[model samples]
Target: MNPSPPLAPGLPVLGNALRMMGDVQQFLVDTYRQMGPVYRVRALNQAFVIMAGERANRFLLERGDEVFSSEVSFGGLNSEFGMRVHVLRGRPHRHLRKVLATGLSRDLLAARWDDVTAATERELAQWRGQRALPVVDRCQRLAAAQLSVAFTGANSAARFATLRSAFELVLDVTIAGKWPAAALKLPAYRRARAEILAFARSCLAERAAHPTGGPADLLDRANEAKDENGNPYPLEVRAGMALQGYFAGINTVAYLYSFMMYALARHPDVRARVLAEVDAAYDGDRLDFERLRGLPALHGLVLETLRVYPPAPGSARTVLEDFDFEGFRIERGKRVLVATSVPHQLAEHFPEPELFDIDRDFAAGRRASVYAPFSVGSHTCLGAGMTEVLAVATVAMMVRRLTVTAPDRPLRITATPGPNPGRRFAVTVAGRPKI
Candidate 1:
């Protein structure tokens, strides 16, 4: 076997793990600057080949089946969570994605707009009399409420705290790295896992008991769906899917919403433009799905937010077999992480990548392969359409309902490992004056 490439030097066994822990994005940018697109890095005594740049990202996301596989990359997930949908690949993978796509199509999403709008309005009403509300927390609750309505037709405000806790537990476990194995092995991890699974099971049971065929939520639809082989998805599989769906939908939507509000507060010009677009699109009333879709500037703003602060900064793929890319041999079984941060900011793909210009023509059609906030290929995010709708609605509602002003200090973005904002902003929202 060809020897693995050398990593940029680091201390002892820990390697560059400490630096990565401090700030993953900046660490990656530094690495790319030093070693170019493809280099090696060591973490937890494991040597991983790191790749960046547009071509590298394309190869990692698109060529997973032939050259690499998510199964290999996300092995830790299976070992911890026991072969959930996120770890499935090959034919089984294709089947699961198809079933998910059926429920998340554009028409189905359009049909569900009323549920989303109602939930958003309900949540916003609670924030009316409060000062110094944690914007991140508020956005999270709003997104969770909308997701609950879409996922299970349940009222989320009462259960938001529990659901949010469960979701955070799962996320914490997944991103713990190798050091937290002891803690994860303890009853805490197991208990959290049990809580999430138990919640899913109850939801599945309820959906099974009342199987609504016409315009039902995600759970109801999944309960009705069956594979070509006539096999219904197992309860565990369904639960896993539900858990993953909530995780995918809630965190990113909330963060993007907060960022949009922050941008509106800071940039009056952009705020005025967004407000004008919302007014023209909806005539200062409820946001219909069709109207939201027609607002191109709103769409551009959300995309730009994602480009600057992707929910998941990097993605990993493990080589299933020896593959040669541009003359470098990637050995089998070695993990390869593609830092998506720098590539999305590449000048070749996005001109003046630093500037937050929503009007930049990202692409003529929706299928901008290079713009991968939802990722691409088989493992692409199943809830992309739903997420986009939720974000657009949340931003539009805030723009229409209140005038947001930033705090006295510049907004401090707490860069958690995920794209979550660490420090919540306190926005002062006054009632919109009559136009």
Candidate 2:
């Protein structure tokens, strides 16, 4: 068999771990340049083929389950989070996915637009009154609260609030690996998991008690969903799905929301144009899905933000069989990563890739397919449509109701649950007009 892609040179024993941890995006970029699309880098004491570019991404994401194992790739997360929705494959995955789809359906999200808008407005209102705080932290908390309400109805706010820090700790563990993860799993993390289970059990009980009287929410959708044989999902499965969706949704969308707003504040002229669109869409009164949908600038801004700052920048898959990938003979059981951020920055794919321009026409041609921020195919983000709506609504409301300016201190990207501001940076917000 042809040798696996060239192994990246690294320090004795440690391999490329330091480089990978130092600056993951840059390491991927630099390695791709020196070694081309396929190369091997070691992390956590194991070697993985680092695959870059849109073609590689499409290959891994689209046809992954056929030859690459999601369970093997994502199973590490289960140590802390339990059997999350992403870890399943084959029939079980399909069944869980079907249930999740119903809850995150466009119809459901549209029906819940009022809650989304109200959440955005409430967060912005708080920001307007505050003197200073890390906008990223505040945005994350807002996203968690909003998603909690959407998932389990209004009563879930306090429970979700309690779970947020523990959720953060879990994310840390998932990224840090077995030893570090084990060491970090303190009482707080256990408490958080217990609280989540308790809250989920309560939701299950609530759904059973009022099968029809309660307001429609994610739990209701999960309760009503069926497996391949038409059996409703077990309470444990439903609860797991709810918790999984909450963790993924809040973490990714929260950073994205802050990033988009950060972009708007950094670019005043673009902000002015976007705010104009938001105001025009609002017309005089309430903001609904119809109005929000019509705001082209806001939609463009959201897309632009995702392209620049994908929350899940890289996705991994474990090879199930020996295979030829791009003329390289990859062996069975080897893990490979589809380095999305590399292609996202390729000069050919996006000219002057570093520039943040909202006017980029992403709807047509290669740009559309090339942009895989939320990934594509079977593992594509289920909440994509909802996230787009929330990102637009939240940013638009912030701009329309308040003037947001970036702090003098540069905001550096760092991983909290995902890539976010290295430290909390103040974004000054003052009233624009009473909404």
Q: Pick the candidate with the highest TM-score.
A: 2
In the predicted model 1, the residue pairs found to clash are none
TM-score of 2: 0.91
What C-alpha lDDT do the candidate models reach, one value each? Answer: 0.68, 0.71
After TM-score superposition, what is the CA distance of residue 403 in candidate 2 from its true location, in Å?
Answer: 1.4
Please identify model 1 stretches exceeding 4 Å from their true place: 1-3, 9-15, 43-47, 72-83, 176-179, 364-368, 408-417
Tens-digit lDDT string for candidate 2 (163-195): 676666655555434235564457866777777
11 Cα displacement, candidate 2 (Å): 4.6
N/CA/C clash count, model 1 = 0
Alpha carbon RMSD to native, model 2: 2.6
Candidate 2 residue 293 Cα shift, in angstroms, is 1.3
Cα distance off (Å), candidate 2, residue 310: 1.0
